[model samples]
Target: MNEQLTEQQINAAGHLTIGGCDAIELAHKYGTPLVVYDVSRIRDQIRRFKKVFEANQVDYAVSYASKAFAAIAMYQVAAAAGAHIDVVSGGELYTAIKAGFPMDRVSFHGNNKSADELAMAIHHHVGVIMLDNFHETDLLSQLLEENDAKIKVMLRITPGIAAHTNKYIQTGQVDSKFGFDLASGQADEALEKVLANPRMEMLGLHAHIGSQIFELAGFEGVADKLVEVASHWQAKYGYQARVINVGGGFGIRYVSVDHPLMPEEFVDAIIKAIKTAVAKTNLDLPAIWIEPGRSIVGPAGYNLYTVGSRKDVPGLKPYVTVDGGMGDNIRPALYQAEYETVLASNPHAPIEEHVRLAGKYCESGDILSQDQGLPATKPGDVLAMLDTGAYGYAMASNYNRNPRPAVVFAENGHDQLVIERESYADLVHLDRPYEQQ
Candidate 1:
C-alpha cells in the first residue's frame, strides 16, 4: 500500500475513497479524466491556519491565492471558511463577484495591470490593491481620482529573498519582474507615490518569496526584512503599517519525500518570526496576512483517469497511458512536476511494477510520473493521481482538441458536479467563419 493512502481512506471493499465517496464509483459517474476535490480537506486546512492565529492571540488573514485553482465553487468554499482571497486578474475578480464573495476581502495583485483592470477593481471596491510598480501606482492613482473614490493600497516590496524552488517559481528575488525592487529604492519610490495620492489609502506592505516552499528559514528571513523596512519607513516618514502580508509559498506533500509542515506549524513559525522582529522596534504589531494556495487545496485534489493503452519494450519500463494528459493537467509537462498514482479500485494492492505513467498528449514530454508503482492494470481500470489540486484544472487547455475533464466536489458521502466537462459544441461556440455574411 502507498503510505499516502491511510487505512481509513480504504473502504471495506478495499477500494480507495475520497471524502467518503468511492473513487471507482466517482469515476463511473463523472467519467474518466475527472478532477475531484475533497471539500472537507479544503475547509479544514483553512481552519488549521486560522486556529494558529486564534491560539496565539494575533490578528491574521489566511488569504487564498486564487491563481492556484480559481473556480466559482472554490471561491465559495474559501468564503464559507471566512477567508480572504488574492485575485491577480480581471477574470478572477469577475469570478469572485459571480461567487458572491465579499468584495471587501479581495486583494488585487498583478505586475502589468492594465488601466481597464484597475478600473474594474475600483468599481468593485476591492479591499486592497498591491502596487507592483510605479506605472501601476500612477495608473491606480489616476483611476481613483477619476472615479472619485478612495482605495486601500499595499506596496509589494521585492525583499530579494530567494526561496528554494524552480528558477521560474522564485518571485521574491531582486531581479524578479513581480514586485518593486527594494535595493534600488524602487519600493521607497512607490510608497512615496502612494502616499502622495489622496484617493489611495496606504495600508501596508506585501511580499511573496515564492511557491511550493518547505523551509522555515526563507519565511523567517522575509519576516525580519519586512519588519526592518516598516521600522525604517516609520523612522523616516512617520508612517505606520497596519498590515504585513508575507505572501504564501508554504509547500504541500506531493510525494513521500515531500515532508511539508502542518498548516499550524507553518503559521506558528511565521507568527513567531514576525513577533520577534516587531519586538525590536517601536512599531505596533501589525496584522499578519498569508496567501496560501497550494497548501490549502493541493492535498485535497485527485485526478482520476482511466487506463487506455500499454506499450512494452524489451529491457525497458512499460508505458501505462491514461485517457487524459497535459491538456487537463499541464504541471508535469510544464515543469516536470511529480505525483503519486494508484489503482482507484484497490490502492493497497501489491505493487506489480514501477512503470512510466504516460498521458494521452502527443508531446513526448507529457509524462505524468517518471516512475509510478502500481499493481497490474488493464484497459478501463481507473488510476487516481494524488495532490493535483493546485495548478491542474486552473491551467487546463483545449490542447489536441481534447475536451477538458469535469470537476466534482465530494464530501460527507455526497457528490456534486462543480465544473461541467467541456463539450465539442462549447469548444466551437467561439468560432466564426470568414465567409459569413
Candidate 2:
C-alpha cells in the first residue's frame, strides 16, 4: 500500500497521509468527500518553478493560472508564495480581489471578455491583459481610451504547433478557439492593431501549446516560432518587444500511464530553445512569463472519499461507490480521465483485486476509475484519489442536487479547513421562489 503512494506522499497506521496528515483522520474529522491540499507541496512547486527562472538568469513571471482551481485561499497562497496570477473572467478576478491579491501581479486573459470585465481589470490596475482576438483588442482599446489608463497587453498567438495531448485540451493548433493564428497572418494583424493604439501597449507575444503535455518538444517548437516572430517584429519596429509570454500547459502525472516533465526539466528545455533561437536570430532576451495551472497544483491535491456500498458484477467487475461523484469531480465523466485510488483505512492491504470506482451521482457516466487495482475493499473504507488538485473542485457542479465538497489545507501535521462544506440551503441561495398571482 505504501508502495502505491506517490514519492512525496506516505501511508501510516492504516491511514493515508499527504504532507504528513492522516487522510483517514482528516476525512473522519472534516467529513467525507473532502479535497485535502498539501500546503508544503504547493509551496515546493512554486519554488521549483521560480528556481527554473532564476537558474536561466531570465526575468520571468511564473503566473499561477488559477483556472485550474481558483478560490480565495488558493489565490492568497499563490500570492504569498511570490507567484503572479492569471484570471480568465470577472468571477476569478473578483475572487482574487476579495483575497486582496496584489493588483499589479494579476494578468487578465479571455477570448470573449465583457465590457464590465475589462472595466474591472482597468480599475484594479492589473499588470497585463492577454488579448485573445481582434474583438477583444478593440474592446480593450475602447475601454483603455475611455478610462485614459495605460495598460500593458500581450498578444496571444496560435503558433500552429499541435502538442501531443487530448484534442479537446490542445490550444496552440490552427483550429483552436484561443489565440490569433500565425499562419493566416492574423497574429501579425493583431500585433499591428495593438501597436497602432496609443492606449494599448504592445508588450510581447504569447503562445500556449496544450494541456497535460508530457513531452518538451511542443514547448521547444513554440519557443522557436515565437522568438522568430519577435525577431521579425523587432527588425520592422525600432524596439524589441519587452515580454514574451509562453503560456502554461505543462503536464502533471495523474496515474502510471502519464509521465510529465519535472519543473526544472520543462523550464530548462524552454530556456535552451529560446536562447538558441534568439542567438540564431541575433535578438536580445525578452522577459518570459509562464501561466502554469495544473502542474503547479495538481499533485498537491488529493480527494478523500469514503466507500458507501459495494457491488460485484458476476464476472465482469466489482463496483465501489463513494458518497461523492461527478458533483465534486467531473474529469472522469467529461474527459474519460483515469485516476489512481487507494484505500486509506487499509494501507497495508495487498492490492490484488480490480474494482471500478463509482460516484454516488445518479448518472451512469459518473465513474471515477475503471478496472482500478486495489486491495480488497470493504464498506465504510476511506479512499483517496491522487493528482486531483487541478480540475477536480474547479470543475465541480451540483449535479443530482448534491452539494460540493469542502476543501482543506494540511502541512506539518496540522490541518485547517479552508472552505466550509456547501449546504442544501446554500445551493439554493440564488433561487427566488415566486407564487402565481
Candidate 3:
C-alpha cells in the first residue's frame, strides 16, 4: 500500500493520529469531509527546499504557489517561514496581503492579466510580475505609463520540452497557452520588448514545465534550454539576467508505485545541470528561484470522509460511497488522479476486500477510486484520503449544491479550525426572492 500519510500521522492502538491528534475524534468534532493539515510537515518541506539550495552556496528564493492551497492560514505559514508567495489572481494577492505577507515577497503570475489586475499588483508594490504574453506586455506598458510607477518583471518562456506527465498539466510545451514560445521566436521578441521598455524592470526569465513531474531528466533538460536562451540574449543584446525563476513541479508519492526523487535530490540535479550549462556558455550564474505548491503542502493534508452507503454487485466490484466526492476534490474527474484511501477508524486493519470508492455526488464520474482495497468498510467508518493537501480544497466547487467542507490545522496535538463548513444559508446567501411582479 502507498504511504500517503505524512510522518506526523501515526497509528496508535489501531487508530490514526495526525499531528498527535486522533483522526476519528477530529472527524466527529469537526464533522466528516474535513481537511486537516499538519503545519509541522509544511514547515519541514519549506526548510528542506531552502536547506538544499543554501548548502550549495547558491542564492535562492522559494515561493509558495498559492493556487495549490490558498488560504489565509496557509499564507500566514509561508510568511512566517520567510518564503515568497506566487499569486495568479487578484483574490490570492488580497489573501496574502490580508494575512500580512510582505508585499516585497509577492509575485503576480497569469497568462492574461487584465489592466485592473496589473494596476492592483503595482498599487501593492508586489515583488515581481511574471509577464505571460504580448498582450500583457502591451497592457502593462500602458498601465505603467499612466501611473508613472515601475515594477520588476520576468518573462515566462515556453521551452518546447514536453514533460513525461499528464497532458492536462503540461505548461512548458511550445503548443501551450501559457508563455512565449521559444521555437517561434516569440520569446526573443518578448525579451526585446521588455528590454526596450523603461517602465518595467526586467528581472529575468521564468519557465514552468508542468505539475506532478517525477523525472530529473525533465528538470535538467529545461535548465539546459533556458541557459541556452539566456546565452543567446547575452550575445545578441549584451544582456545578463540576475535571476532565473524555474517554477516547481516536484511530484509527491500518491500511490505505492510512485517512486519520486526527494526535494534535495531534485534540487541538486537541477542546480548541477544549470551550472554545467552556464559554464559551457561562459555566462554568469543567476540567482535561482522556485515556486513549489503541491510538494510543500500535499503530504501534510488528510481528507476525512464518513462512509455513507454500500452497494454490492453480483460479479462486479462492490462500491462504498463517502459523504464527499468531486465537490471537495475534483482531481480524479479532472486529471484522472489516483489516491490511497485508508480507514481512519481502523488504520491498520487487514485488507479484507477490494472495492470501488464512490463519491456521494450524483454524477457517475464522481468516483474517487476503483478496485481499491479496504477493510470491509461500514457505513459510519471514516475514510481518510491521503495526499490531498495540494488541489483538494483549492479546486473544490459547489457542484450539485454540495457545500464545501471545513478545514483545520493540526500542530503539537492541537487542532484549530481555519475554515468553517458552508451551511445551507450560505448556499442561498446571494439568491434573490421570487416575489417580483
Each candidate: what lDDT? 0.92, 0.87, 0.90
Model 2, global lDDT:
0.87
Q: Which stretches of candidate 1 lie over 4 Å from their true place?
A: none
Residue range 213-283, candidate 2, lDDT tens digits: 88888999999999999998878766487887888888877888676778668877898889888888767
Query: For each candidate, what TM-score against the reference?
Result: 0.99, 0.97, 0.97
Candidate 3 residue 195 Cα shift, in angstroms, is 1.4
Ranking by lDDT: 1, 3, 2
Clashing pairs in 3: none
Model 3, poorest ten-residue lDDT window?
A: 1-10
| True-vs-predicted CA distance for residue 79, candidate 2, Å | 1.0
**Candidate 3 residue lDDT tens string, 27-95:** 999998999998999999999999988887888899999899999999999999989999999889988
**Model 3 residue 153 CA deviation in Å:** 0.4
Candidate number with greatest lDDT: 1
In terms of lDDT, model 1 sits at 0.92
Following a full C-alpha superposition, what root-mean-square deviation does model 2 have from the true structure? Answer: 1.5
Q: For model 3, what is the error of residue 164's alpha carbon versus the real structure, in angstroms, after optimal superposition?
A: 0.5
